[model samples]
Target: MVLDTVMTTLHVLTGALWVGSVVFVAGVVLPAALDGSLDAAPLETFADRLVYGSRAASVVMFLTGGHMAGTGYTFDLLLNSSRGHLVLAMLLLWLVLSALVEIGRSRLVEGLQEKRVRSPARNAMGVFRAAAVVGVLLLVDAGLLASDVALY
Candidate 1:
């Protein structure tokens, strides 16, 4: 029971870190870059941290989430219940958000490599916006699952 609690806490923290970072980058950093207020050097550094932080968080979330699912749910339960459906949706949303971050980061990196700002920031903003939306959905789905809200 204690182990489950620990795993759940870790899972939630990592999710928050991942979602928060993406939102910060999309809403704050990228906007600054697009407005010519930020330089490539700092942006590159931030992007590096964001990429690595995201990767570490992803691994932690995956392990913790798998542990939770393994301990609390069976294959049958995962496939047959509304809560299970939410879990599946969470997984899908995670994948989508991860991909969006990767793509956005790539665009930013490519632009930074050329010492350019506004173009890359503009290119990535749309993807990051989509990711933010999905991140919110993922959080909402988790909340619904936790609150025992029935969805059919």
Candidate 2:
């Protein structure tokens, strides 16, 4: 029971951090940088700092979530139960989010490294928008999953 509680807490906290960071970067940081309100250097620096934390949180969430799923539900339950369906949806969302973050970051960093000063912001904005939309969707799915679990 204690282990379950701890894993649940970790899973929720890490998930929140991962999603919050993405939203902040996509909605606030990218816009500010593009508009010239925030300088590119500082924005890049801030993003660099966030990358490690975001990735770490993502990994932790995946690990804890997987552990919880494995221990709490059988394969039959996963396929047949409503909660299982929700979990599967959440998992798919998580995979997409992970891909978006990685691909976006890679493109952003590549542009930065290439010193594409004139276009990096514009390019990054597109990636940020894409990631942000997916992140928001993931958050909604998570909320629904939590609500379903609570009612269960």
Candidate 3:
């Protein structure tokens, strides 16, 4: 029980951090950078920090989530249950979110490395936007799983 609690807490905390950071960059930082209000150096620094922080959060979420799921779920339950379906949805959304962040960061970094700010910001904006959307969906999925809302 204690292990389950710890795992759940870690999973929730990491998920929030991962999603929140992505949303902040996509909604706030990227726009400023794209409009020339933000400098390349700051943008580069933010991108690097966001990417590294996200990577760490992703790792934590994976480990904690795996521990919880491994102890609580079986293949049959996962394939046949509504809660299980939500879990699967969360997993898919998590993958999409992670990929989008990485791709967006790469786009921004590649542009920054070239000493160009606005163009790279513009290039990464769409990807980050997608990530933000996915992040929201992931949150919703998690809420549904946690709440009494019926998936069916």
Candidate 4:
């Protein structure tokens, strides 16, 4: 029981870290950064820090999945099981995309830091848009997967 709980906590933490950073960049920071004269250096540096952390969290989430799966849990129970195959699959996909976003953000930040700003805000805004689009896809996937699962 305790092991299951611990694994679940790790999964949730990493997922939150991934989601939170994306939300901050897409829903708040990027738009504001676009409209203002905030120095690219600070924003680039900050994005560097966030990219590293979220990527690490994504790794943890992936690592935890192996052990969670070894427990002989039935797959695709999804939200019904709270910690099942469907959840893990979705998490895996999310992680992959999160890593992609991190890579894009990292490259853009590096460009800005190198005085290679081909428009930092515009480039960053593109990354943010991609993240938003991925977020919506994840939602739709989850809803479709949950179609037959009973909810209270």
Candidate 5:
């Protein structure tokens, strides 16, 4: 019970941090990057900050989730448990985040390289915003999952 509680706490904290990062990147940084003057150094710095933070949060989230998966709950039980839904939601968020990092950041860098401040920034910002909204929804669903032993 105590271990479970710890794992749950860690999991929730990881999710919160990840979602919060997503929101900050999408809502704040993205817009700022889009509007501000696009210098390669500055854009690279901003992208580095976002990427580092995201990777850290992603690590924690993965660890806590992996811990849960390694517990007494068999694969089938987890697949059928409330944890399952939360895992799926986490996966969806991960996919969006990974895609954003891969495509969006690279595109942002390319935009910086080519000095197309408006379109590339706007497009990257749009991707971030879309990811943020979905991440928020999935995080909420994970919270709901935390509160219940069964979500389906």
Candidate 6:
């Protein structure tokens, strides 16, 4: 029981970190970049920091989520339960967000390293916006899963 609780807590906390970072990037960083309030070099540095933090949080969430699922849920429960469906959705969302952020980061870093005149900020902002939307959806799903009201 203690182990399960620990795993659940870790999973929630890590997930929150991942979601929060994405939202911040989308709501704050992207706008600043778009508005010229943030220069390319500073934007790139901020993105690097966000990527590093998000990557670490994603790994922790993945591990803890897997552990929680394995220890606390049966295959049947995972297939049939509302929480199971939410978990699956969250996993898919995580994958999409991770891929978008990593690819965007790589492209941005390459452009910056080459000292190209054109900035990748536009592309990065688009990616961050998409990820933020998905993150919000994941949060909604989590809230629904946690609530006592039946979803199905």
Best by lDDT: 3
Off by over 4 Å in 5: 1-6, 37-40, 149-152
Tell me model 5's lDDT, rounded to 2 decimals. Answer: 0.71
Per-candidate TM equals 0.96, 0.86, 0.95, 0.71, 0.78, 0.86
Q: Return the lDDT, model 4, position 113.
A: 68
What ordering of candidates by lDDT runs from best to worst?
Answer: 3, 1, 6, 2, 5, 4
The candidate, 3 or 4, that scores higher on TM-score is 3
| Predictions in order: lDDT | 0.88, 0.75, 0.89, 0.66, 0.71, 0.77
Looking at candidate 6, the ten consecutive residues that score lowest on lDDT are 111-120
Candidate 5 local lDDT, 1-152, one digit each (tens): 89878987987886677677768877776677667745556766777777776777677777777787677457786678766757666677776775676566776777776765666677787777776787788677776776775645
Error of 6 at 99 (Å): 1.1
Per-residue lDDT tens digits of candidate 6, residues 21-110? 888877887776666676667767877887898788888878988897788678887789877787788788888888877876776666
Q: How would you encode candidate 1's per-residue C-alpha lDDT over 18-107 as one tens digit per residue?
A: 999999998999999999999998998898888888788878978998998898788988899997888888889988988888888898
RMSD of each: 1.3, 2.2, 1.4, 4.5, 2.7, 2.2
The parts of candidate 1 lying over 4 Å away from their true place are none
Total clashing residue pairs per candidate?
Answer: 0, 0, 0, 0, 0, 0
**Alpha-carbon RMSD, candidate 4:** 4.5
Question: Could you give the candidate ranking by TM-score, starting with the highest?
Answer: 1, 3, 2, 6, 5, 4
Candidate 2 segments whose C-alpha is farther than 4 A from its true place: 114-118, 149-152
Q: Residue 4's C-alpha lDDT in candidate 6?
A: 84
Residue clash pairs of candidate 3: none
Q: Between the candidate structures 4 and 6, which one is better when assessed by TM-score?
A: 6
Name the 10 consecutive residues with the lowest summed lDDT in model 3. 143-152
Model 1 error, position 152 (Å): 11
